[model samples]
Target chain A: MDYSKMCPKFESAAELLGKKWTGLIIRVLMGGPKRFKDIKEQIPDMSDKMLTDRMKELESLGVVKRTVYPEMPVRIEYELTEKGRDLEEVTNSIQAWGEKWM
Target chain B: MDYSKMCPKFESAAELLGKKWTGLIIRVLMGGPKRFKDIKEQIPDMSDKMLTDRMKELESLGVVKRTVYPEMPVRIEYELTEKGRDLEEVTNSIQAWGEKWM
Candidate 1:
């Protein structure tokens, strides 16, 4: 989507991260690809519905990838795309900022 | 407060910026000190009550400062404290991260 044209006129850069849960989701993804339960384990407070919704949103946004392995239980895993991996710097910055301000 | 000891166990940094509106408020304050109206102008979607609450939260957190000038109109301005300004780097990182992920 041409997010630049979106109303409220946030910079394309700002609009993406402005959404709720996106940052925290990305932060957890930093630890590496994990199954649905692994991600869920990391964020016990986030309901399964919310986590699924955020994962879909992140995937649609082109920052996260979902992989399903052909197993009896059909294991599913999530990892950052190359583009998503680039977000590490910003995450570090956020962690740093949170340290000082939060 | 000794936020580090708070339950749910967020890093001290994450605890601060993780709050709703705190990040956006800091993002706006990056432009410089702003009056109540000025800040509101920058974020028309935010209600007055919410903005007031966020300012108080940030001030008490020691990341933002409120200055009241005894003028006819009774101007009250808000700015980032030194610790607050340090958040700029983190903000920049968030902006950068948002660019890739969102």
Candidate 2:
């Protein structure tokens, strides 16, 4: 949690982003903000509990922002903040590598 | 294993690299080829079993190559492949992000 003491930056960042569903969650959000169900639609295999947990982690990291709209049927949406958008390059690079290697 | 079937690139790459300690292992190797003990020295908290397992996975993924010397004691070293070097940008990006955020 205390990444400041974690020495190398890549090591801390990787530890934070290298969780099972964390990358996928960020990739899906890269498409822009989405409602909870929409995110679920993209990663169908992820269980509701796992999604919630990943979202919480991302939210805590300031990568994802949660917004609620007061409506007849409460609406909730999750979007990447400015900090999260900085990872666009990282997402793109990993995707390119995966295409060529994996 | 079949990342092609996984759709998005980030999802597959993350699944492959997102496991615990995988990122740290790659970061250590980025300093150039290193013996197993040297790599272990960089990440003192990682268990031998986990390090061995991560090395095996990276080897299988072709990101890392294992070589054994024919000399007396048979020295072993792990080096990143050409394909692995392509990840330099990703590593840099994550490190920058970690420095700025986490």
Candidate 3:
């Protein structure tokens, strides 16, 4: 229990998840894949530019996978990768805590 | 599974925990009550001013309790309230994910 030294892994994880709107974005995706508009609709307060930025960040981190369907009007969708799905525990815990306390 | 509407409780919890250094500070305090110096020492990159600000924020949120023991020289300690301790699940989930992925 003596956490005299900070753990780098935890620090990195915290940094990734601690980004504004990152957790909620992940939470939204937890339900399943969705179009850009769907994701945007869920988080009304987040600007389009911010959502774009966070999505790209998550995509780069391999937490999210963006797929483009080559149709008349290109269909774009976002979904969680396995790694992203792994965060269910983290999100679920947060939800539980939030419901009880926040 | 349809999270069409964002949960206010989850949003509030995410906002609180997403703040920089907040999770790490809580993680450090998870060991037990520690003096300000101890907390700062664990998170070496955080400035004194930042730590002061975060501690005050956490205290005001009722997630942290600050105690002062009157002596020749006053001794102070920071500990998690029951509400704060409840965050163990959240922190632990993050730690587990970090170790596996981050």
- The candidate with the higher lDDT, 1 or 2, is 2
Which CAPRI level is candidate 2?
acceptable
Poorest 10 consecutive residues of model 3 chain A by lDDT? A1-10
**Chain B TM-score (each prediction, in order):** 0.84, 0.89, 0.96
Better of 1 and 3 by TM-score: 3
Docking class of 1: acceptable
User: Which candidate should be chosen as best, given DockQ against the real structure?
Assistant: 3
Better of 1 and 2 by DockQ: 2
Q: Residue B67 CA error for candidate 2 (Å)? A: 0.7
The lDDT values for all models are 0.70, 0.81, 0.94
DockQ of each: 0.26, 0.49, 0.77
At residue B64, give the lDDT of candidate 1. Answer: 89
Candidate 2 lDDT, A2-65, residue by residue in tens = 2223356667788878888888778878888888888888789999999999999889888999
Give per-residue CA lDDT, model 2, range B36-64, as digits (tens): 98888878899999999999988988899
Alpha-carbon DockQ of candidate 1: 0.26
